[model samples]
Target: MQFESVSESRLSFVVCFIAAFVGCAPLLQAQTEPAAPHTFFRVKAAETLTAPVSGRLLLFLKPGSGDKEVSIDEFHPTATYVAAQEIHDLEPGEEVEVNADQLAFPKAFSELNGGLYEVQAVLDTDHNYNYAGRAPEDWISNVMALAGWKPGSTAEPELVLDHHPEEDAQRKAAYEKLKGTATADVARLEEFESPALTRFWGRPTKVRAWVILPPDYVKSGGKYPTVYWTHGFGGEIDSALVSGLRIYERMKAGKMPPMIWVMLDESCPQGTHEFADSVNDGPWGTALTAEFIPWLEKKYRMDARRDGRFVQGHSSGGWASLQLEVNYPKVFGGTWSTSPDPSDFHDFTGIDLYADHANVYHRPDGSAYPIMRDKGQVLATAEQFTRLEQVLGPYGGQMTSFDWVFSPKSVSGAPEAMFDRVTGDVDPKVVAYWQEHWDLAHVVSTHWADRGADLKGRIHVYVGTADTFYLDGAAHKFDAVLKGLGADAHFTYIPDRTHFDLYGVGDDRQGLFDEIGQQMWDVARPGKSWKNRQ
Candidate 1:
């Protein structure tokens, strides 16, 4: 007030003060920029495979460094509804829990029944569980590929996107084309009836088990010896159409002995179950022996006795088959396991080492942090990290299998186990837990032979030298242990072939096929005029 009638200098100072207060000058600004609103991820939801299944539900809000919250209201109440969008907070590297749930509707639509639905989760952040740009061949994509999931056509869609209308149309068109085509039909393999989706081990599982009618089924009502074929990791019951049994089909047409082949689905919901008894996980070992075998015998006209039955699988399934034969020698007369997970602590290639160390056995503090991504000593390059991720994706997705089979629950009801790979500098308590349940070094030597006495002359084992997965060492160690036990175990190592090559349509496919069939025949008939023994 006193300076109201001041000179030009005072007047200029008062005007500038008012201008700053009124935001007319550079000094005046909003308290804070409205932070880039947390954008939710947009996932596309398809209504193809929703019959009795409730309304088309969208899973939202994944964990670990991404968006944490999701809203379902954005999902299209009608047709093209936005399924889910994740709310994110911009921050440094952080971990979070990702989640999704099925949206339930009271009724089922009859028209839209029994078809496959392709849903997509748009990855908004550059931080993918497996970064696509840096490592294109990571596990997330590979598992999706195996499960028949394809990307949407949109420009870098959100974390999860429903398969676009065009993609679905393209899939139908491709299916029709393949169905009617008469070109070199290398892709078409055998198809069989898959049983209804039933609950096994408290999870949704489908068993596509079949019985090959004995050659003299019409002539003789008598039961025939049966070969119970269990498949390896990711190996479906239908894979036998491309395996040794496929050649057995050809051999039966000529001179192969007439035996019944029952290919059982050894896979649970999480994929391969390793076919073993578990504490927290479902009892696959009991399920295989009690549920599957009994179900097969009751359904098919075959000798239900042990002498007429056999079991076989490769890799993890190989380990399952061998362990099952040993555990239930009276239940199965013989077993042929290939590239088994036999050596426990001594074999460095077990499951514990390969898992994302962060997810392996946890500490009392709830963190299972690894000292380093590679062996505790070695460092991995970006490319190596990518490859290690690729390898781990398959095994990690199937973690339930290993966790259930090898690592039983502790007194506290937690998975308290560790593999030798991570055992060197890992938590001593976790290592003790693993040692208590499945120290294969002790199990294989102490119990395997005693349990497998009935299978002395019938056990057959094999592994490939160039097996891509370094699993041959465990298999070799297993062979030596079985021989030491005075059990009649046979082994064959295929030269110049990797694990992947031997399972699929290999260059020496026919020869490999023939050899496997001969082994089956030897177990089935005891005396057969087939080849491949030499």
Candidate 2:
């Protein structure tokens, strides 16, 4: 057995295989059982890669018109046949038969009668399938049309795996166009590498921030108040570059005050770390407070005092900013967090992980817990998302990202899973660790006497009632705790608003930026009215 090094290409291929296997399961019944009921389905797939491929294989099945273009999002794991297979040194042009009995199927698929279905085979060469978007290296098999197919049907369609070179070219061209259009104002964004992070990872780790300098700074020899803006999950330093440019534009136009904005990037391979000092994510809170902030202050013309420093973020960033303010009260003057991720674990995404026999997949009454949504309609369940992610490998995803940030390290050198992936059994030990360390509400409630005085009137949170991820539940829980303790924390709930548009005030989507800027200005320059801005 020869093991190969796992490169980006190989990981991508492996992930593709995982996705394909999780999507469809082919049936293969034993030939010895002549009188046995037909209880199997199978599909034959051929590899089309130029080089010999050795990785995982995935098969997907969906109820659709076989002539139409198939999308991976359209097929749900619960309603489809899904299976995985491991291959070693499989040469190009080799065909393999995938058996359905070895695959996992939802209850809905078990009772399915014979019908029309489309089957596809995904050959993942590198195990990084979930992150790859229609890349040519992600070899996908031709959609096989199975009409009137029942269990143990001998009519199996042969799928030929092929790459989409044209799509890849188009994606590259679009990215190049975006890069070419970046103006001189965008060049003001500076990137920073954190020594703390490098030491933690035992390698050079870089974190970027868009440092928008105050206009006319070369002539104006004065230090300015700083706003440390954190980005939410999937947000990178480049993504916030436009916001920094807009800030410069607003300042130049006299629509906003002259203040420095530090757009910090909190994204990691495991998702946004939320900058919480954790055993798993390696003291990010400490790094941000002790190392990053001090370096930033020294390098820029920033007012180093607490009164001049403030934090603001939305969603995951929101939770992080609030956490930073609460943890290091003297370091940051205040935090204006909006639509943050669960501040209270009691209502974490509407499911209490600490509950007895808690299962993320189902509610107490045995209803499916929703995850992805659009306009209040559920697109996928929590279980479906988790299962798909599990197939996609454990390193980089929303669920695993939380584990990397909150859970303790396991003997396997990875973060301990909060719940069993297959059974959805809540791990009592993990829950206890999360509550003690990561749960903001629990931390504040337990240590109110010590930290309460400094945190008073400094913690301001905003959330929409119709937040797509049900983040409002956690916000409400945190609000109750704050009110009970007379913590002087401000909590606002907007009506009929969703997470994406929480920042929108009236008609402008970027209105929240200006609103937050004015609020920060008010805090930095007390007795100055925002209405009387020059």
- Output the number of the TM-score-best candidate: 2
Q: What is candidate 1's TM-score against the reference? A: 0.56
Alpha-carbon runs more than 4 Å astray in model 2: 1-60, 65-69, 74-90, 95-137, 141-156, 164-191, 214-221, 242-256, 372-377, 528-534
Point out where model 1 deviates above 4 Å.
1-160, 164-208, 214-220, 237-248, 350-396, 410-414, 417-441, 503-510, 528-534
What is the TM-score (0 to 1) of candidate 2? 0.79
* Candidate lDDT (C-alpha), each: 0.46, 0.71
lDDT digits (tens) for residues 325-415 of candidate 1: 7668889888877766544544534324323342232333433322112112222221222222222222233333455456656688645
* Count: clashes, candidate 2: 34
lDDT of 1 at 527: 70
State in Å the error of residue 455, model 1. Answer: 3.8
For residues 27-77, could you state the per-residue lDDT of candidate 2 as single tens digits?
113223454342443333345456766655666677766443343562243
Per-prediction TM-score = 0.56, 0.79
